[model samples]
Target: MDSVKLGLKENWKQFALLVIVNGFVGGMVGMERSIFPQFAEVEFGVASKTAILAFITAFGISKAVANYYTGKLANKFGRRTLLLFGWLLAIPVPFMLIYAPSWTFVIIANILLGLSQGLTWSSTVVMKIDLVGEKDRGFAMGLNEFAGYFAVGIVAFITGYVANSYGITPYPFYIGVFLSIVGFLLTLFWVKDTRDFVKKEGKNNKTVELKNVFLETTFKNKTLSSVTQAGLINNLNDGMIWGLLPMVLFSLNFDNENIGIITAIYPAVWGIGQLFTGKMSDHYSKKGMLFWGMLMQGIAILFIPYSSEFAVLAGLSAILGLGTALVYPTFLATIAQATSPQQRAESIGTFRLWRDLGYAFGAIISGVTADIFGVEYAILTIASLTIMSSLIIKFRMPVNIKTVRK
Candidate 1:
């Protein structure tokens, strides 16, 4: 334990490796993001919006369950074990996507993708937190999320372009095969468990461990629950974008390449903005970041429904991404600050359980609402819910504008 060092500079090599590994994780999601809805509508003849989005529901629910368990199981089985085991699930995904003759197989593939994401993404997150300790936690989260989401942005554009050039089936999905293999080999060969870092940090950590991690993270603690609800709302809106944005752009006559660029812009801005937002959290007020961030996202979502021009929509997406960037790292950093080292993993899992559920609820709600009320109404509904979430954070979470970080 005496040999353990706890700072980003000290763990740069491992941290860099984990960042690259997480990029692969986000790339997995990217492969499906920009084109799946189009694929369903075109290939499978599934025109019902709700039916097309069932894959996201499956992904959300499965990922939520896996996230909950990953936290409970992390310390017991070891992080590396959970990570390697997750890759096993990913190996079959691209093949499943490429060959599926029916919609059911696509749903099954997303289920696998969600589970693999839960385990692998959760492990990398926990491991990075374990590695960096206290000094640069927010920056570490920023870099971590940036790597993952930026990958999502990049892959989305590539696949969208590829799908535009070569008919959307075998070619775009080929990237998934390469990513899964590289991600797996990297984790198996180079990734190390962070249990030792946890042990080291725990020795000096004085924050009180929660009596019940789930209850407190979910509802009992005002500060934690505030952050938790904001996370759910963030992802909820994101799910809406994931499941519907392409369809909306198509309704306006934009092609796949354009839809891909518009879709990628939001996450690209989100990924890049976090590089600064994360560091800002360390120097500035987290509460302000959360409040304004959610507000910005809400405003952007509301505007999205009104935009018909390509540049206007793209600009709105960037604003939305920037808003999300403001809060994404802050959410994790706040969670880490509020909880003790002893139960951090479970607390994070509990928070993510509800957060990922937003994806399902968003997909289901938006899908059904779009089917019934129209796409505009569906967008309006999510945007309203997002604003309400921002208000919760503003009123419930305590203001901590003066806290300083080195």
Candidate 2:
């Protein structure tokens, strides 16, 4: 831990770059997420229920695909080049959504947005693990997720307010475009390659192999498998919360402002709570942190349908956030610890691909369920799925911590 801490402190420039690039990437995605549902409703006259699903489906599919390639690209070309390319792809995203002649254009933008997410955001997480090594990985991941989601929560609320005031959804898209351009430029001008970190450690001379990069080797380790599975479930719940919560509020007859306030609470709490949770991961077993986090998330989801008042719902949202905070960083730390340093990028990418697929699976399932039954029923179903996932982790998985060295 002391050596890891010293390395991070000495490489402050690299870590600062990670924080800024990842934070901006988060804000870019957050901007889209904040406004897309309203755009679907106001521009295409799509129902709130159906439109949100479009964004989720596009995001899930594109991110899933991009996760596979991002690792390979990072391995072949190096992380900085791939990251720069990803930021460039983001430049047109907001314009596509804002000037979209049909819902299909907005969907296309989301696909591109998802690509940016996988390439930039997912890669940044892997990069952090690269820089921080094993011992301080939890704290590093906590800071990473905290910056990203906190930007999302704040930007979502602000953009939601912008939409309500102007009654023009494109305004937010325009803002997203500008921010993404800034992020792109920042990466181009300021961010440096951490491949030097790997090179400095003399691992860069090894042959790059693609075989088994995406295979059972990933699942061969019990600890890695548990963390990966838990990550999938955690992201499954995240997809539900981000994909369906607004519609849940809409179904309850809340306006955009109220929806924004309610929607903001989950990520806000999740983001802020990481400060403590990240430190806790250092002192406790990663498995213990994850197990309790999943349990709390399940309990929070169960409480969602029962809360009729905004205050109670907000409280439940915070509880869910805390649960997410507990699990999110620990999961990343576990993945970093379980894999060899040389293969960390590919391993984390593979892990994220599975976790992100949970978003697609949860969205399609919950969307169809909501269409058939109602929002409350959809919430209940996701709650049940989450609880089942928690049980799987608690009972079936081994509780152990593994660490790899540089």
Candidate 3:
């Protein structure tokens, strides 16, 4: 621990292991991405769109709150403790979902899931930043998100197939049970604490000039605030997709398997595309990448309801994924770059608090809109909101914002 070094190559073993752990963390949520909403409607007879999307609402709110605390606690307790404790919270989520007898039970399960995700995912993000230092922060973030979301896509695809075959109850959620145990064991035994690395980096670093971390990351600093809002709205539209995409296809007469395919494709492309886009942010202007990425996401989302053909919808979903790939890792990289090592975790937690809150907002807003005007109009409104977020990024963010580099 005393010989701690910074760089992905230096920490590749732990970095690789954390990536895998985060994948399982992602898989914990991915299992539901394709099946949960449909399960609510079909299994429990949930009739209201708001009621069907209640789980996402529960998840978003809990995760947002958890993200804020995970930061504060990680600094106090250590990242590994938070990571393990997060998995402990996750232990019951799968069984709750599998054996749930009421819609309320499902929502309860999501509350736990959100808490677990906030801690585990947030811990991994901080751990990776701790290990990689400043050199390839973008690439490191890209890898972290890629592993997590790709696993999301993979599990979503698998669960969709399972639900199509075994019904939504017992099989689809079995993935979560397996992931919860494996994520806990691997994180406990294999992953090491990276807080020392942060200490090491801080010793030799002259770059970071700290600010009021919460206020600056949340709203005070120009570039940080821009990234924060973009992250919020990015996930805002994503929450719309997570809660509504499968339902839209189902209403269009698409079967469960097909629904999974369409649903899986979006994050699949998003997960895989970040392989390059993350590195691109390291080299290119983050502002440009964010501007175009948000614009593309808005466009892709706007076209989803209008496209009746499977190919076209799939194409649009892929486009949406690509757009997200461009910005998702960039968001974290930029946030990490903006703050000092001491402040990084808290700042990240703040950014993620608002970002995950978009999930709640998207679910509630889309759910209410879907209930009132229908899903199509709800989606249209969400897309318009996304486009507006992009414009905010374009005009409000400083063109030449400085980021701390160690």
User: By TM-score, how accurate is candidate 1?
Assistant: 0.98
- Residue 342 miss distance in model 1 (angstroms): 1.4
lDDT of 1 by residue, 1-406 (tens): 7888998999999999999999999999999989999899888999998999899999999998888899999999988999998888998999999999899999999999999999998899889999998778899999989999999999999999999999889999999999999999999999999999998988877787788999999998888899999989899999999999999999999999999999999999999999999998888889999999999999999988889999999999999999999999998888888887768899888888889988999999999999999989999999999999999999988886222222
True lDDT of residue 237, candidate 2: 78
TM agreement with the true structure for every prediction: 0.98, 0.92, 0.98
List candidate 3 segments past 4 Å from native.
404-406
lDDT of 1 at 398: 84
lDDT of 2: 0.76
- Looking at model 1, residue 77 earns an lDDT score of 93
Model 3: lDDT of residue 63: 97
Off by over 4 Å in 1: 401-406
How many residue pairs clash per model?
0, 0, 0
Give RMSD to native, each candidate. 2.0, 3.3, 1.3
User: Local distance difference test, per candidate?
Assistant: 0.91, 0.76, 0.91
